[model samples]
Target: MCILFATRSHPNYELILISNRDEFFERDTHNTCWHTNSSILSPYDMARNQKTSPTNSETFGTWIGINKNGRVANILNLRPADTPPNKSSKGKVSRGMIPFTFLNTDSRKDSFSEWDSFEKFEHQYPCLTTSGDFNFFYGDIKSKSYRIIDTFGQTFKVLDQNDNDSFVLSNNTFNIENTKKWNKTEEGMQKLKELISKTKNESNNNIILMECFKLASICSVPEEIRNKPYHVDPAITYDTIFVPPLGSNDGEDIGLTITKGDFYGTRSQIVILVSKNSKHVTYVEKVLHTSDRDCKTHSAINPKDFHQFEFEIE
Candidate 1:
């Protein structure tokens, strides 16, 4: 996924994750669904070329997911410009493998500790490797602990639940230290903070929370900033379609995907809401269909794949 919004501390919920997975519309992917591996049922993904592994028939891998332990892990692929490109692309592990490795482990901390040593993991599976350039965010709601593995920043930022409750991460570096990411950081944070403010004075309500996340998922930058007389990537400007929260007929039927005739637009949406004192989480994922901007037949093309998995967090 390219864009991620997460809040660890909420007045009514333990955690909230609103994410958009942006990729080329042509990249084939399986529907996000629950899978059973030794009786553990969680949302899983299968790569386009499902022959990569024997378990591909059951559950392949995922870029982001939550386990039974209230532990959530999501990764964002760093753009080629953000880091030096790999010289030899002969062999490499899929980014989705990390979540599977973490969820299958008995101890979450141990799994992370093992992940900290990237070299050891690379040694085990020569082809299963990451560039150490991706942004890794994981946290345990029950433990009230979270951390961001900032490969671009070259630091492991440990976040206290009380101290830092909300965060927004995109394909670019999100800190002011890097001049390249300053504008995006400013715009994204503003929209996120607005969502936080809207839900601040309310009790635990899943519907309200979903709407808040929708706002984050579809928020865009100002026209003046977007149309600035400069050569820049449009993805940074965040011009995307808006989808209404469930149970509302307020949005357009074809407004599911970011069909803006550009590269790396919003291809899918994954929204997760975990309420405080609740055993399960509400998970919704929708992978939208590609549209033909010229034909105006986009409404006929609904989401190509959609899945909803609501279950206990253990």
Candidate 2:
């Protein structure tokens, strides 16, 4: 599970993205790496290659990333009911590949029309028909456009940047007003609104945005509810719990006990800011802890282990 927040209409920035990566701690995962082509910081699953694979594997990490082309993609698993049966199911394609796949290709200016003009998306990407349901938000600076693409290949473009300046995406169903259906949807949006209110015109404020993301990531659920399911609550699902998969048995023990053999909590946090005028991108990654492969004891480390960089889109 993950939570992604983005603001597109700020005075100083074209976009601001805040994300928390939640997953099993026993799996081998790398924090961030600058891709060979450009200054794209892609946090990859160390265990698998970039190809079609089962979603349950360790390679199923990272649902967000930004490229040097000034294109950004954020994906979330759609609720089963929201996704209809695929008419073009070829086979299972890794849902994690969506962001990177978009980044690999340059975006066109016309938005949805150009993409839909193709004879078949399943033909273009054989996995699209068979991949698990996903909600993808993609934007490109060159195209000056942003939109959401669902598993069914439906696209909803953002016509008014000001109206849809800020958006929060969690595991719950997609709703603009953020109704009080799921526990995290209302609480997370409320916290984001409060933070946005505090810094009214302060665009591209990474520090405050990072803090807001941390708040949403760590916010506790109600105590009245017993037997809290992690999927229903972002607090438990995205909690910053890091466990190294090597050396120490502590990580395995914590994973077994805390999540009851399910995936662990938040492993990494990323904050990205893109400037509209200059098209310069600022990316910051906070790796919560070092793996046991590097440190034997699986010791607790500071969240300040940040890897940051800035680059301009050519």
Candidate 3:
């Protein structure tokens, strides 16, 4: 299960967002890199199962990204009915491109920034989102404005800057007023609040980043529960933040193909910190597996080696 957590509660930072990207060990992924063409920074998912739209000429799509203009965009795939996401079967759309579009076209004059108004945003973006069921988060740190579009629910939410709260989204609905948060979301929020308290006196950004990594790695499912036939249960998934490969030990060719991609688990972790003044952004990503090769040649690829970068927001 993939999870994303963002906090505006920090005293020194405007936003501290961390995410755990869970996927099959075999999925091809491009490690975090700066896009020289667009001045955007993000990793790319090369799953080309879906038919491409005219706007999606590029073969790769992005689940999360940030631009030099201080726009941040991310997505969560609402936990499909199938265990390993059934990549080859029924998915007609690539959800990552929603965030990719946001990061690329968020210039103020470009109607993308009009996301603050529900009607304007709804009128503009629903066409792009009509094919997929997803949760998209778009934020302009320079404007201190954030908005969430849930294509599944057709709901538009503008995150209140004045709230100064931590928001956590897993595979569940984020209508905080109408729905109860999943255990994972609640626990993430509480842990984030505690992190804010514990690091109140800390000055080193690196330490804070490490703590965020540890915070995202809270994934440990009981053997009894994990060994059982995998169910698409949110409680079972939300039980922990990190997920180890399932059915890998029992079988040798566990995560060999998209058809045999049952070795589902957390593959990468991302932590992004934006300064309170919105002048700088620190982006860090640690890739645990780029392909099945990393699983066997563990020592060759240092999993904890983070692709880290800092950029001044223009």
**Best candidate, TM-score:** 3
Off by over 4 Å in 1: 36-59, 80-91, 108-132, 150-153, 174-178, 204-206, 219-264, 290-306
| lDDT against the true structure, each candidate | 0.53, 0.55, 0.69
Worst 10 residues of 1 by lDDT: 244-253
Colliding residue pairs in candidate 3: 219-242
What local lDDT score does residue 281 receive in model 3, on the 0 to 100 scale?
88
Q: After superposition, how far is residue 245 of candidate 1 from its true place, in Å?
A: 20
Residue 269 accuracy (lDDT) in model 3? 88
Reference-based TM-score of each model: 0.69, 0.71, 0.82
- Per-residue alpha-carbon lDDT of candidate 3 for residues 1-314, written as tens digits (9 for 90 to 100): 57898887777888888988877767777888988385789998876433457776555667888998888988886643233633322134567666776677646566445665435555555545453556677788877778776754454555465674668887655664424556677788788888889987775899999889888877567756553335334446656777655444433322122333545667888999988888988999988866555555441135735689998998
lDDT of 1 by residue, 1-314 (tens): 26787775567766778777665343345556544454333444433222345554443556677776666778776543333333222114455565565555554445444444334444433434443246667666565556665443343444455566677776555453554663444555567677767787776556654665465455454445432223334444333433211111222112122123322345577778887774668777766644223122221135556677777765
Best by lDDT: 3
Of 2 and 3, the candidate ranking higher by lDDT: 3
